[model samples]
Target chain A: MEPYPYTVNPFVHQDRFWYPFVSPFDPCPPIRAKRYVVPPNQFLGFQPPNLLQFPPAQALMKGTLWPALFSPYKKTGKVEIKDP
Target chain B: MWVYEKKLQYPVRVSQCNPTLAKYLIEQYGGADGELAAALRYLNQRYTLPDKVTGLLTDIGTEEFAHLEMIATMVYKLTKDATPEQLKEAGLGDHYADHDRALFYHNAAGNPFTATYIQAKGDPIADLYEDIAAEEKARATYQWLIDISDDPDINDGLKFLREREVVHSQRFREAVELIKEYNEQKNFF
Candidate 1:
């Protein structure tokens, strides 16, 4: 007997994963191009302040990840998982 | 042009914050060799990069952003419950002493953020080599973080970040080789 016409396609499956409210496909919001333009007048050689010199203990952990805080698999990569 | 929908590759959950851990992870945010600096460096350099190095810089620069998010999440979580006692337990009392209960936004060691970490030099060969070094440094830092972390989940994330750094370093090295080959054929010297 033929299958019901309304039956879901077994070959096609929807990802059961949850997605974020924000979509990644959205184009990066446009901002004034000058926002990123670096000024040429500034002395270029000025060393970016090196903060690594202080002992690691001195560093503050203001915004790091917590062990049980989030699920690493909420989002998956498009790339296939091949044995490396 | 073919367009593939883009999305966050990982889900970030805002759990209870631990101020102490936040203070330490801040190192990755604005530290001298932190992910923030790395992202800014590669993104800025991409503009001046030759075609051969463009993809390399973009890929690496984007990855730095993920690292930045990871670090930021860590800090936020650690500080959610910023109690003096908890802070002490997390080994963040020293940071709290100076900052006085305020979680300052700076690099790992409370250093102010600056842009001097990156250099374009207008030379692809030189920049590509620098890129490789940058990746190696980041990889080393992630490895160090993993070594210090006692949490299994945190360690897993750190391990992944460390591996990514290695892959990026390899890519930059390849980009260097490509530039050399191009120059050799063009100059024929």
Candidate 2:
């Protein structure tokens, strides 16, 4: 089953990608790009005054009153980590 | 002087019995990263913090207790009707033998809850940073719980809990900024 059928807009900027310095001599094939999380809160070192907020009902559903602060984590991609 | 609301902060719906899932959910119930640890950690830190920070801690700490109750509700509902054999099969045999359906403060692996799970550094900056980390950890826990959970009804509750962790983390971050500003002003004077 597809855990998340719909996609979130990448423009939302909730997450970021980084290109690791892969060694050509390494045994395993180096992956091109990797996704790393920079949660919404990370951008806001200090919350601004009077940010836009989700409606009360939607707020409860989203788990945050402010839309900017809500980082949706869907169960789709499997986490992959390589041992150094 | 806190008001007791009979209803849950979020509607918890556990559709069917699955003790295996319940066993995994116990990590958030009595685990080091669970709601009880969060509630106690923040509440204990509230006393020595700046007045503004203290109020925020109180608010978040109290909310964590409510979250704990919701976790407890789910655990209880999951295990309420299971037989000893069923529970034993679900890896809760020791829990059943010792506690017998009674909710014990222990992690998924059965390590009992201890005050050591929580920390109160007394300094606002340290405590708020710790609080933010704690909230993020709890959010990750909820995400893993949701990933493992196949029950939609249970997932709904877990989703709510996870989101609360996000909100709390942000609030603590803002509080950290506020406390820093407060300290700067104090130094200027």
Candidate 3:
């Protein structure tokens, strides 16, 4: 039997958009929606009890046992690879 | 005492031999925020830390060595087949002249790895914060390396490494909280 079998909080967001107020006298153009991350740890002030876990194979592949902690990163720059 | 694990923590299969990528990969292998620095820093800190979190440090430190091995595997596979001329063309001429395909502890800019890269302060908060910053920096480094490299296999390895940083950083943050709670308990006495 799978432990903590139900997928938990997978839809909970990790990335947050911080919209800086554009000043009229600013030298550069208004840059909106600067994407930033609120990593899993921040959401979890401390690791909570009975956390859902990935299966052994999936855990090794995801780089963590807890599914909440697996944050796939997308690089922010010239090359645009698809974000997970 | 640590037992030798023959298999890599994560599989590292290189699709092509790109010495340029190998050069970039060395930064993580030996640079300031690299795995070696991380392993040494955490392991050294473990001895002085409160007993509860000491095990965490040891566990993560040991894991960093696995990460270090995985990186070495990638670098070795990438550069193993490259000719001397090919290595030179990839901006490793200076390295080739000195080491000749042998791995040296140096950063992308050719700075040798030094003790200054790792710190073991007695203060738990300070050490944990340093660890947190190191993990974030390594995460960013992997992101940039992944950005510039085109090889899918190398990127797969880099992606795994990058995600590990996230896990480590999270653990360190939790450790900080754990230490703080311990301090509060100590104050009660």
Candidate 4:
């Protein structure tokens, strides 16, 4: 069976005076050539901001999956990597 | 455990105070398909997903948190120096009355954010499909915002975020494929 033919409207209309009345569905709207100028470089550091000062030896571990696979810190202290 | 970053994923500097635009942009900040909802949805769904998919969701969810911060920063800058008269003229009287110049978690129409904005279905396929739709919706909202905004700084930030949504959608589609392959293999046995 052929499906009913219908065209979709990519706009949403709002009746509120405060909000934008019409909104189009183009996620990346084309910017004007002159308006596409880049901002002045502030000479910020290239490296990511490391706000937390953790010890150099401490490895950051995230999520439970890794811990489930293997734990570096063992309760029995059998295979702990000692830093001499 | 998430680490605190002092910087935004994209810079947001609003040179002009446009209370009207600020009101509209608030939708993306805390709306149904907003970054906050996206972050929570993906993070919560990761628990039931397979290892690799869990990692994807975790990373994307973390990125969404940064996007949320960017949106909040834009909103704050827009409303920072706005006078009460200007806010009232911009039809932001009610919002100003409630929270003053401070940023509150609410949509354009002033509805507070709720957990019901997103669903964390245990099924991988269902969750991935939802994530894709969520990304598209967020992209559409950002488009609308970009269409109305004239400021170059705000537009640049919105453009970065809109592109991120598209990328997230593509990644979620790949995750869906992975789940389908896994299911096929499981059924063959």
Leading candidate by TM-score: 3
TM-scores for all candidates: the values are 0.58, 0.84, 0.85, 0.68
Candidate 3, residue A68: how far the Cα is off, in Å? 1.0
- Which CAPRI category fits model 1? incorrect
Count backbone clashes in candidate 4. 0
The positional error of residue B137 in candidate 2, measured at the CA in angstroms, is: 0.9
Q: DockQ of each model against the real complex?
A: 0.02, 0.53, 0.54, 0.02
RMSD of each: 19.4, 5.4, 6.3, 18.2
lDDT of 1 by residue, B1-189 (tens): 223335323434433454554665677778767888888888888888778778768877877887777766666665765777887677777766877555454766666787777677878878877877777677556655654555555555565565566556656766766676656366655
- DockQ of candidate 1 compared with the true complex: 0.02
Lowest lDDT 10-residue stretch of candidate 4 chain B: B180-189
TM-score of chain B of each: 0.79, 0.96, 0.96, 0.95
Cα lDDT for residue A32, candidate 4: 19
True contacts kept of 2: 0.63
Report iRMS values in order: 13.8, 1.4, 1.5, 19.4
Q: Model 4 over residues A1-84: C-alpha lDDT tens digits?
A: 211134422111111112122337656652212111111111112213443433433212211111111111111122222221
- Model 4 C-alpha RMSD vs. true structure (Å) is 18.2
Give the per-residue lDDT digits (tens) of candidate 3, residues B59-143.
Answer: 9999999999999999999999999999999999999999999998889899999999988888888888999999999987898
The runs of at least 3 residues in candidate 1 whose Cα sits more than 4 Å from the true structure, single-residue gaps closed, are A1-84, B1-8, B11-19, B88-105, B183-189
Kindly list the per-residue Cα lDDT of model 2 for residues B1-189, writing each as its tens digit.
588898888888888999999999999988999999998898889889998888888898899989999999999999999999999999999998899999999999999999998888877788888999999898888888888888989988888788788778988988887877645365553
lDDT of 4 by residue, B1-189 (tens): 989979876667785899899999999888999999999999999999877688999999999999899899998888889899999998899988988898888899999999999997798888888998998788778867877887777876786677677557767877776676655355654
For A10-46, candidate 2 gives per-residue lDDT tens digits of: 4255544556788879898876556555567767667
